[model samples]
Target: MTVPVVYSACEAYPTVRFVIATQPVASSLFVNPPQNLTVVGVDVKQRYKGTHGIWRLMGDLRREYAIDAFIDLHDVIRTHIMGVYCRMHGIPMSRIDKGRSEKRELTRETGKNLHPLISTRQRYFDAFKRMGFDFGETFTSVYPTGADTTLFADITKPKSGGERWIAIAPFAKHEGKIYPPGLMSLVVDTLSQRAGTRLFLFGGGGYERDILEEWACEHPHNVTSLAGKRYGFAKELALLSHCDVMLSMDSANMHLASLVELPVVSVWGATHPYCGFTGWHQNPANEVQTDLPCRPCSVFGNKPCQRGDYACLRGIDYHAIVQRLDNVINQR
Candidate 1:
């Protein structure tokens, strides 16, 4: 007797492609490959410009790629619009519900009403499930491809004398989530006291990079800035993988470090781990965030602290982080 086989679109359709409509930050987190995924980075400016243009682009994507199924990793207004287009075109669509976990925690923490049950990664996976893919079976690590690896060759250069180094990703896309330069300086200084360890800073060149560079100059022997170093995401990963550990803000670096399997000392400010975006792919060796009542004011951090004081981050003692790093370095 012959056995019957069932095939979903993802399986039946050998040419499975993914259209990732998300911001750069979110796309950096959601975009994965070897499953034949194609990411269409939603240009923030273009999407914000006009509703019709955004819809038109969605239509174009639908017609152009003949996209089998659409996954809105970002379930915001823009993605909603695109999802509608996909549906109108008779294409199945899925969106990850990112708010469920946060909603649960918020109700418990603030004594507020339960919002909803959703999670960022879960919502993303839901899109696949809609097309007959099991979330558990399909779940895979987000990895950099050959192109990505090629991009980071320069920055991932081996250190002289085969010395081990610690990477510091101090700059966050949002200023509110960034630790103050003075506080970071203290952390770097404390870490520098440990011999045989080198410090390399990672970030794009900007005012924050300038500030970090100034701090690095103060401790020239132990610290150096690799912020402006021309490396792509893949190269950054390579450099991150080479590090003994990473000290980073609660930003994309946390996710990236997880992908590289580096031990991360994540410093939190306006954000908290309960948001579910914390170090999903990396080992979080230490999480340094003040237990402030006003912590996690928003799901995504804002420009300034909502309560003016920014106690969530400002209250975090620099000494605590130093002690954690000391323990990590001094461990037998």
Candidate 2:
């Protein structure tokens, strides 16, 4: 989505080139990206380690691209340090407005505010706008041409008859945001019984694999687990393009599904969509959540529930998720 957001700036100023500085691992997500845009793979863990590293990065950027302006969407302590380097170089720059105060109101334990905050993308657009590179809506995050289909050919087969494919991402980095594994398995078991539907379990290559694989084995004919697969990001993206709808927690998978312009039925827990983390152009109606006063107890779902039990998550019945999935599948 950052590529698309910045690509709009490239459109407005045809002479301009964009240096999309990202973590080394994530650079693979872009395949044959725009000619005007250069994706710089930065290793914050290795190459750019401290203040000295940031200074080196600044020098490299100047020497490599002779770039005049900087827009920092990643408003972290590290990026702030990098912005200082940009200032020292006499470069014009704009950092993102994270709307921390607005986010606070939404996540507070007492007298919670339910109004939506300005979206992260809107802030990105605004940051570029501050640099006088005004642009319109972002482009879809679809893969560029020349993707290798063979990567998924052996692992994934064509849908038989009027079959519909559903991708279920049942894990989040913070357990507070994810539905319980046992309950999610129940959701999978129920969905597997649906006539003309096939389930695909998605997760990172870790302990998440064990849980996802267990659910997949139970419905061997109808389910497949993509966790810890050797296939790269581009291929995983290509596979997601074929899913009818992504059933996900408010996590990266939901955002990834949106990148391919796929419909997502996202389940919300401690993190509310109102906090501006909703997937790109996803319908608010598709958000499945139990409405409680303390609904959005945390912003990123990293904080523990003050109520002792995480009723916000554990209280969500398995049937509710399945029913919502049924509606999303039929409506789409």
Candidate 3:
């Protein structure tokens, strides 16, 4: 008989259906797939707010799906509540220890010489194996569907209109994660001097959007700030998809650009790709980051650098990045 499993997290559930749970967890679980699955999403924010209600929802879902097993990709207190509820109902469940992964990354960032461990992608698979699912391959996958595409308009903008374009994503969830604005401007100015090249900014509305506008005003005709403009993630993806290349700090846009298969020049500050959250869908050969002693200051880049200098990002050689960009764009 086919095993009945319910997979749930906050996002990305359609792809990973087996033993699914609600949002965040759902989203993380959807990154991997297993046979005989039913996916569910619990739309909880990253921060804890509606956690008390999660158990009630999970209880309802369990009865509805006759959920045999619960796979908690999100191991928060809320998930713990669900685990307790599942036990009360005599339903077997397993949880992926994301906190341990975070701790491992933190240890590595703090100059601790931990033995080289499995990739983040592999760790997810290993989590499943603990619950009796055996899978191989450690790389994360991103498959954009029609629903994801519907976020953008169908019109293709011309890239050859006497302008060499470089896409810039300046905003990330954390402030320290961004490359310093002065440095960003310097890179844009240096690159704009190349014939037919211009800078196209991509991001949502906020303080960073204001910064992009200020940069655009300073550069006038060369820099176009589209940060707060009318464009969905799909449109942004489509636009970045056509650009010769992209320059981004560590953020969701980095992942989005990767999905479009864009050659990205990533700036690493508080976080590092070795933590396993690097380009999920892009070519590994194209990622550019600094190898600093104080690099990878955090797992999610939520904290400021302990040292005031932020040398990991501030110390990056602009010339080297430009050279790498030349190689990537020329080959494309």
The numbered model that scores best in TM-score is 2
Provide the lowest-lDDT 10-residue window in model 1: 1-10
**Which structure is stronger by lDDT: 2 or 3?**
2
Ranking by TM-score: 2, 1, 3
lDDT string, candidate 2, 198-307, tens digits: 99899987789988888888889989998988677777777787778889999988888877777888888889988888888888888888888887989999998778
lDDT on C-alpha atoms for all candidate structures:
0.64, 0.82, 0.64
Listed in order, each prediction's TM-score against the native is 0.78, 0.94, 0.73
Between candidates 1 and 2, name the one with more favorable TM-score.
2
lDDT of 3 by residue, 1-332 (tens): 00111221213234444545545522442333344454556566533247567666776786687677776655777878888888998888777655565555554546554333445545555566676666443322233331242333343346556556688887688866877788777877788777788788877787778988888887876788887786554456556656778888788767666655677877777777666666654556666677767666677788767787777777777777777778878887
Per-residue alpha-carbon lDDT of candidate 1 for residues 1-332, written as tens digits (9 for 90 to 100) = 00001112233445655454545644444323335455556665765346787787777776777767766655678778887877787877777666655554653446544332343454545655665665242222334332343445554445656465888888788777888877878888887777777888877887867877887898888787877765556557666666777888888777677665667788888766666666644444588888666666665676467678777777888898877765654552
Off by over 4 Å in 1: 1-15, 21-32, 41-49, 100-119, 137-153, 160-162, 283-285, 303-307, 326-332
Q: On a 0 to 100 scale, what is the lDDT of residue 296 in model 3? A: 65
Best-performing candidate as measured by lDDT? 2
- Model 2 lDDT at residue 44: 76
Superposition-based RMSD of candidate 2 using all C-alpha atoms, in angstroms: 1.9
Which regions of candidate 2 fall more than 4 Å away from where they truly are? Answer: 144-151
- The TM-score, computed over Cα atoms with residue i paired to residue i, of candidate 3 is 0.73
